[model samples]
Target: MTATTTPLLGQMMDVPLLVSSLIAHAARHHGNAQIVSRRIEGDVHRYTYRECEVRSKQLAQALIALGVEPGERIGTLAWNGYRHLEAYFGVTGFGAVCHTINPRLFPEQIAWIVNHADDRYILFDITFAALVDALAPQCPQVRGWIALCDESHRPAMRTPVLCYETLLAAQNGEFDWPLLDERSASNLCYTSGTTGNPKGALYTHRSAVLHAYGASLPDAMGLSARDAMLPVVPMFHVNAWGLPHAGPLNGTKLVLPGKDLDGKSLYELMEAEGVTCSAGVPTVWLGLLAYMREAGVKFSTLKRTVIGGSACPPAMLRTYEDDYGVQVIHAWGMTEMSPLGTLAKLNWEQAQRPPEAQRALLEKQGRVIFGVDMKIVGDDGRELPWDGVAFGDLYVRGPWIIDRYFRQESGTPLVDGWFPTGDVATIDPDGFLHITDRSKDVIKSGGEWISSIELENIAVAHPAIAEAACIACAHPRWTERPLIVAVKKPGAQVTREELLAFFEGKVVKWWLPDDAVFVDELPHTATGKLQKLKLREQFRHHVLPSALEVGDKCPLEPLDSDKGAASGATANTKSAATRG
Candidate 1:
């Protein structure tokens, strides 16, 4: 018998989760909160949320007056500043898409992205005037250009440009944000185009808002109103790792460092603004640590920092946690994961473990946050157990994960409703994840897969080595072998033999690097990750003469560490570094 029951309607209101609501909430509740930015004009710009909202409305009006329609793409080529943040809200709030352009990309890539998106207007920073001028001719679909500065700062350009201040000043009436569908696209961010041409990630208001909430939880970024937050990450990439939205949501005091992310500038800004928490890549912290060591400086108010883009070296983590009173939160994500997937924070049970034991968990990428589910799949697409030992391809599924890349007729990025993250990782029984390497970057030696990231991490721990990247170089018999491309520390010396021997007992005897070649500098992406593609191409025919001499067995005769062809490390780094 069929049962019949009454379907009662709930009393809750169906309010759309629009980004404009976030700004409006901040304006009403946290109006007095400060938003300080080091402007491109070499001056510090300061304003409150109340003032920011008013200006955003005016900018929204300006955008509308310029013939921007709902769902239109409004591009921005600016750094992390007040104006960029304004464009973020104003463009989306006015029912248009804000495509934050990464100027670091190649000229052709930039032109392709703008023309492909069919951007109506582009707001460029004064520093990028020449770049925009050069690109405008290639992108005929762009209606016009707006300089993100006062009339005085606008450069004499070949194309007609309007000033940001002038445009906002012309609009006097208060503009109301449109009732936008939460599922509609709100922002567009393209990948870095490492393998093929970059593809756009279309983010909707619902996904963006839900992602903000997920990232702000205590288990995640844990931003609070009392905390003075500084996002050193660029605003163009993954919405600056979603810090901008999280800030206003939590009423966290924000400090935006313009373009100069050097040690001196970052240190001064952090101290001046009392930055309690910061986020950036491992390379960024390397520079800051070097500067602090040289200048004998200590962090006054800076307490916690989130390190991502690449794995954080164990030595760097210890320096921030043990040497200085700063907490290093290791995180992992891709531009596709709304940029934040996992954060390495110890749970109560794990925190009670001894420091040595705790380091083991700290070294792995953090566990997945709620609202995000992850599983590792073998080559056959079958799910693997969370046994710490078996590393497999990582796949994730969630509300925010991309269903399909923008404008691609190519099949969806998901396999059976799960997004394959192109990462080789191991998940422990406790849900901790360790990202071994990118699928393309993993070295396939013989029949086994060797993690390049793991090898590089072990190599950089050597005191004489400043920076390192591991790439799969072609070999005679093994098909392929691991080659470490290294940068020597200043005033230090170490031979290839010594560098290879340094890996003794730290990894499997067979897993040791076949060769160590020193280079002046390693190529890096704009987001601070090692560009292994370039290294692979550069060393495609690299011959491991030294390792070949030893045959299939380990080499005998470890060279002394004090002597080498190049420079660095006046002192023994073995003791100074975190010895595995």
Candidate 2:
């Protein structure tokens, strides 16, 4: 028997075709929709969808005039601003892959990424001018640099730089968008690479457009024209969780937070723009929450917040939902998954339940979105039950999911068409996923694994703590133990005993932090996940007492100035005795 060809379910959409055509569609359909940008200069920039389209077309023409080749990469080191958004569509709309380089990464990492992506032209925001200058010497592949600034904020650099407006001025407003293959690469983002060197995930035009569509669904992000969206997540990260495209497609009001992500600035922008929806990692929300409590500021107009790039603590969910009236939507994904695999939007059945019940359900990352499939596998490579109790490595596959890493690296970890997301998770009977920890982050003590994320979340719930990270520390008896590194809230003092008490009854006694160390700040990855590796390195030499070594007195004590002085003299005396 002959195999029959399958019929396509949706319309074909290439990068230029989808982004440019959507611009035209939004201009024709939702021309009155607004785009608000808060600049670093403390000025608010405003434009309508129609005006944005006009500018985007002008930018596309300008990019063409700058000699941007059809498939060449155009990099942008920008914040979440109108100019960055313009570059997003303008570059991809003209068939060039928009490589958004994360400025937060180390200068060397940034240079490596630019060189790896082979970006021909770099469009940088004013705030990253110094960063660009630092990385310019290392990135030989970057042939041209354009500063995304107007006349007032022209970047000052020793190298000959092209002004964004000047380039636009040189070209006509009209340019033809090439009709390219749907599977052609469009956008590129690198993983935070907590485990290894950052790897690029090249997204195809087809994948990006599909991701935008999936992300806009009511069951996904539930975005619409009626909503005003402020993407607190940087544009350099996972296409800002695909909000830039989904916002325009849904005709939602776009609010760009620019370079100011501090609590006061973000709160003011959200309030002024009447932002109904926003998206960011938990760290950003933590700052916003602290600001609200300290300043008595409230988000009266905000309704929903998409929190991801790290686990959203239950306290954050409750504070936002019950106290502030903003629904905290937990989302989960990696750079390889088009950065959006699941969203925590409650279904109609769950939404009708009590708020407490709904919040409990929302705490777990919600069901897989349409076109996405998820499963869990145990150590023996057997599929685990979705009973919520069985924990295993989570694997996912979807239309928009990446099949392989860019540049064809060996050991790409794609198995049977599914990408093994390094995250260890449990899927409940209701199909919600709860991430326990990353495969490498889970601490195995005495042969039993412990979830570092669970410990960290519980520790941070302590009122005096601002943030927390738990890492596996070397143990003489147990073979491995947990060390909690925490940053205390400003003006708040917390002792190790106080924090350990907070974990009482919340987790297993064995899982309690063996030692709690206070730091000014917890190290975070570019995507905002806790950098436990750094924490481990910081406290690796901490000596713990064994059963025989333990006496009545505790081995650990606060380091006092007097003790240091005594020890300093002892060291000198010992040196003199050795010389004699």
User: Against the true structure, whose TM-score is highest?
Assistant: 1
* Model 2 agreement with the true structure over 230-311: per-residue lDDT tens digits: 9999999999999988888888899999988999999988888899999999999999999999999788899998999999
Off by over 4 Å in 2: 1-17, 351-356, 409-411, 545-580
TM-score for each predicted model, relative to the true structure? 0.93, 0.91
In the range 1-580, model 1's lDDT, one tens digit per residue, is 7676967789999999988888888888999999999999998999988788888898999988888899999999988899999988999997899998899988899999999888999999898988988998999999999999998888998988989999999987387888899999999999888766888998999888888898898888899888899998899888999898888888888899988999989999999999999999998899999899899999999888999989998878887899989989899988788888998989999999998989889888898888799999999889999999898999998988898898885779888999999999999988999999998778888879898988998898999888999987666466667888888889888888889899899989778888878887888886788987766655543556644664734322211211231123232222222222
Report the C-alpha displacement of residue 120, candidate 2, in angstroms: 0.5
Model 1 alpha-carbon drift over 4 Å, by segment = 1-9, 546-580
Best by lDDT: 1
**Clashing residue pair totals per candidate (backbone < 3 A):** 5, 0
Model 2 TM: 0.91
- What TM-score does structure 1 among the candidates reach? 0.93
Clashing pairs in 1: 489-568, 491-568, 492-567, 492-568, 492-569
lDDT on C-alpha atoms for all candidate structures? 0.85, 0.81
